[model samples]
Target: MRVAVVQVGYGDAEPVPERVERVAALVRAQAGHDLVVLPELWAPGGFAYREWQDRAEPVDGPVGQAMSAAARDAGVVLHAGSIIERPGGGEVGPDGHGLWNTSLVYGPDGGLLAAYRKVHRFGFGAGEPKLLDAGEDVVVVDLPLRDGGSVRAGLSTCYDLRFPELYRRQVDAGATLFVVPAAWPAARVRHWTLLAHARAVEDQCVVVACNTAGTHAGTEMGGHSQVVSAAGEALAMAGADEQVLSVDVDLDAVAAWREQFPVLRDRRL
Candidate 1:
């Protein structure tokens, strides 16, 4: 599968609408890629605590609309990244936070394929934990490939990368591809890279980690968007900038590696 990982950045100076336009143009440019991924909360600003509520919108809102059109125009499946979703229904979380940090996926036809609400809120007492409700469902979707078949993809947001069991669950659910959209900061870049490799090797699956770049609200984002093969080899990686790292992954290799090692089958659980 051909994947295009778009590492984007935006600070307090750029307007949200303008940022959306810039990202949409990038997505539209990946016409031949089977899948296109983006970083989390690029529009609402990942670390911009003050802007979350004001920038929150539904899945079909302007940002989603722009991404849908972009996916359709480019003729590729697009992982539009996580958005600050201000959904209705009056539902509340454990901390009384009603909003959700949601990840959205669009098909080649510009249709909404899946929406994964982040189950693991990042902040301990502030930020996401205080402002957003925790997601309950584990989301997995079949991303349609341009060549006719589909790839089973498991979805998880930024903080979820630290949890290996979550990815083990994806592996059990028949997911050969794990898509992690993160807004990880520069301070923890080592953890981001190490954990990504660990997950790929442990789960024996393709790991596509798309991280944010540039400074947002005085916070520096770690921008090493990468694709790791089933053997934990880095297929492609990007630098700390607004760039796209495209790589080709062989899904069949995942099965081959698992069969050769056969470690997963020995699980007592």
Candidate 2:
């Protein structure tokens, strides 16, 4: 599968609407890729906590609309990074934070394929924990391939990358590819690269991680968006700037590697 990972940057200077328009164009530019991914909270600044509540919108809001159209135009299954979502009709979840950091996936036909709310909230009682409700679902969707076959892809965002159990559950659900969109900071970027490869090695699945770049809200985003093969080899990686890392991945390689190693068969617990 040919994948395009868009490493976007969010700054205080650019207006949100303009950023949306620019990013939509970027998505449209990846016409031949089978799958395209964007970084988390590119529309709403990742560290701009003060602006999240004001900018929150529903799944069908402007961001989703533009992404759906862009996905159709590009003719690729697009992971439109994440958005700050406010549930419509005044509904509320368990935490009652009134908002969620949600990742959206769109099909080639611009149809809504899946929406994964981030299960792990960051900020340790601040930021996400204080402002947003936690997601309860483990999301996995089948990505349609050019050859008429499909690959099961598990969805998680940002801080969820640190939790191995969540990915293990996805592996149990028959996911061969893990799609992660993060807004990880530059301070802990070393952990980001290490954990991405670790997830691929431990789960024996291909890991596609897309992260942001540039500074927003005084925080520098880590932009080493990468693709790791089932064998934990880094197939492609982007620099700490706004760029795109396009790589061709073999979906069948996951099955082949797992069968050859047969490590998962020995799991007792």
Give the winner by lDDT.
2
Count backbone clashes in candidate 2: 0
- For all candidates in order, the CA lDDT equals 0.91, 0.95
Tens digit per residue, CA lDDT, model 2, 1-269: 99999999879999999999999999999999999999999999999999998899999999999999999998999999999999789878898887999999999999999999999999999999999999999998999977788899999998999999999999999999999999999999999999999999999999999999999899999899999999999999999999998899988788899999988899998
Q: lDDT score, residue 176, model 1? A: 91
Clash pairs, model 1 backbone: none
**What's the number of clashes in each of the models?**
0, 0
Candidate 2's C-alpha runs over 4 A off are none
RMSD values for the candidates in order, in angstroms, are 1.0, 0.6
Q: Per-residue lDDT for 1-269 in model 1, tens only?
A: 99999999778899999999999999999999999999999999899889888998888999999999999999999999989987667666676777889999999999999999998988887788888889988888999998899999999998999888888888878899999999999999989998999999988889999999999888999898899998999999889888899899999898899899988888897
